[model samples]
Target: MKKILAVLAVGMISSMAHAATVGSQSYKDNIEVGGSMWIPFGPHADSAGLPGVGVKGVALGQLSKISMRSVRKLTEQNPDYGATDGNNVTVVTPPAHGKVAMGNFNFAQLADSNAEVYYGEWTAHNDTAGATRSVYYVGKDKTANMPTSGTATYAVKGINQYSGNNQLNGTFTADFGKNTLKGSLANNALNVGVDAKINTAAASFNGSATAAGKTGTSQGHFFGNNAGSLAGFAKFDDRKLDTAFGGVKK
Candidate 1:
């Protein structure tokens, strides 16, 4: 029985290795790509004409290409290395240029909680050889331990605007921020092609989303009608994923 079990384990390992070999190759190719939201936003975009128009400041860093042909493989060797343990993800790097010359926050996203599941922070190589930058949500609402209904919040998670629930009606920007989602940039990116356009930019923001289990309004603040100021949840829904999020600033 022990020998049989050992053989079975070996077989499983071999199978995984085979799959990993094949999957890694394809995954590397598929994963080594500039995400749809890989624009030059964040602080670098500058808070100048933001919420208005024009350059939206000017993206500090734009991940033009990601070469996953050779990546850091700590997860493969150590089980507890990365949080995801997928061992498929690789560090992302910017090509030649597209990075703004200003304040830091370079690979800030990598250190954020979101990077645990999504890609880790994308450290930049501005000053040194590697800096980090994870994400700049056009919109995402993350609460502290998922608060009850009607709690004022800030901070978004990702770029997925249009988050809906029973009570909450997050009317996202609807334009995907006009930069990556509505301009020549997104229309000409890798993986995310022109067809990847988010045609339905939410026109109406939803306020008051109830918890999936709770019958009463899910307990959260509804960014109601407020002109000139953003009002809506972008990254999450009602199941505690909802919170006050400022999707796109520029």
Candidate 2:
């Protein structure tokens, strides 16, 4: 019986590995469309020591070619990694000119929970040395434990899509009683403000954002003990900017 159980365990591991390998190609193709790649959004635990960090980069002509090959390979290795429309991946560095600048969150890992979202970066290179980097977050919502009436502030990190992955730092405020959320993420290049309605049962929020007289939409979710953390993604309709942001309650 012991030997049988051991063999079954091994088989299960092997089957999972095979599925991941087979699924990666399809997932990559689905996410990368017309020079745009999907990124996951929502609250995530800072597992792997990589809390979500904002990135800034320049767009080079070689970005599309390099990122496609690199991201596919990374997905092949991390079958569990996935992407969604909430955010996007922008290729930054070109390898021929210099070594790709590595960032703090430079590798992909499996999500810590059944519900998942991801953050990522890329390195441009012609050879196999080029690769995409990513991290996963567990999405959690403790509705019962969530405070019914109160206001809290969260410090956030933002990625500016219009300004070559411009990094925006800012804060968000949530009012539980009002079922409303508001915040602004900004840098010298741009500033965006968001207002949304919160759905406590789902531990999520969605609404509109405005920047420089242009309007956009935002969506995100709450995470952790009693919904103590929040994260979101946004995009402008007329402006070339998109953003991802998150922070913990203080």
Candidate 3:
């Protein structure tokens, strides 16, 4: 009997590799939340490759619930990436822009977090597209710190626009456990003609994102007086999980 069917196919490949190594070690010991995030608003071009001035629209949302709690752990990778290590991520917007709210809080440790590293702060408020209100404050200190292996390097500041205009400043850095994320932006006179026509700019942007899918790409550049100076780029070609209690969730 063909050696007992090759020992039942090697015991079903050793029980599927012990159930994927016990589901990646129980996704690194619990604190596993779900995911869904999408950000797209029209008339674009504040920087990073310009080009979107045709007034379109698309700003969908759904993060229904995102919770994670796994404190203390200096090693043993994969706990849902340490429940997004030093977690704090909020995005609730759905009422056609007027229901805008954004947040990012880590307070400390997130280059990759090997311990003794800090830099994190981001807050944003909004009222989508036909803008009526907007606000943003950002931070990421710890210029450079290293305790013999627990690396660090960060610098960022912020002030956003749309509430009387003219206010946009940004900076970036990363290197904790190195899943990498970068940034850059500068603006001070973007009064798009109401007879004020002011436009001064400086831009450099980078992108790399991951959770399961929907890759990344972003680029920008735009110069003053609008006589022509623009560049743009964007790519995140795949992501789908629609559920208003219907079907689709994968």
Candidate 4:
């Protein structure tokens, strides 16, 4: 019993040491192919590995705090680095357009990795047409000290590749007791519903999504000090668009 307690105490200390907090925004990018969106940055964003080929380097930025507001007359930008991925609750920040918006998404990745993963939605005001909408993050996965029971609700944001890379926002609920997640995203245009089962041991999840008569598969991982955030990708059956989303514990 003493040995077991010692091991458990060590594990707890390690997790608290790597707890999530505000850190530098290292890099952010997204991709569109044949009208579908995909993440171009991640823990291996700078690796020579295939599939995404990784990025040369990350564009650093500082996170700010603001409030939630709807973006007006915005178009999706193919590639821009002038936005912050902010959750629509708690902390908020104003975008380049001078509009107030929620913006607090900083978390720690798994200790074995040097990458960070941030998830939230943002609009870039660097475009002439107006601005571009996107979902982004800057860390990897860290799911230590996660709650073993109870439920957590999150405010989610993402990019819809089919809708010209438009912004998608909604809420997601994670049930730690049942190890499940359910979420929905919609605007004045369309709605998307997602469901997934959580693997508590792996700190990951996979499931299905439905939207406008189309079905898709969704997969993502949990992050933060106590599994306070999540981010993932969804690919539809029609191959029309891809959705990437993330959120913070609300």
Clashes of each: 32, 0, 13, 15
lDDT of 3 by residue, 163-241 (tens): 2232223333332244232443334532110001111222122343221233434332221121111112222232111
What TM-score does candidate 2 reach?
0.50
Q: Model 2: how far is 108 from its true place, Å?
A: 11
Candidate with the larger TM-score of 2 and 3: 2
Name the better of 3 and 4 by TM-score.
4
Candidate 3 clash figure, as a count = 13
- CA lDDT of every candidate: 0.21, 0.46, 0.21, 0.47
lDDT of 4 by residue, 65-111 (tens): 11111111011121121232232221222355533222212111222
lDDT (tens digit, per residue) of candidate 1 on 1-250: 7975564344334322321011000012111222122112322121111111111122212222211111222222333322222222232233344233211221111123221112112222353432122222111122212212221222222221111111111222223233112111111111111111221123223222322232211111111121112222211222223222222222
- Measured on C-alpha atoms, candidate 4 has an lDDT of 0.47
* Cand. 1 TM to true fold: 0.18
Superposed on all Cα atoms, model 4 deviates from the true structure by an RMSD in Å of: 14.3
lDDT value for candidate 1? 0.21
TM-score of each: 0.18, 0.50, 0.17, 0.50
Q: Is candidate 1 or candidate 2 better by TM-score?
A: 2
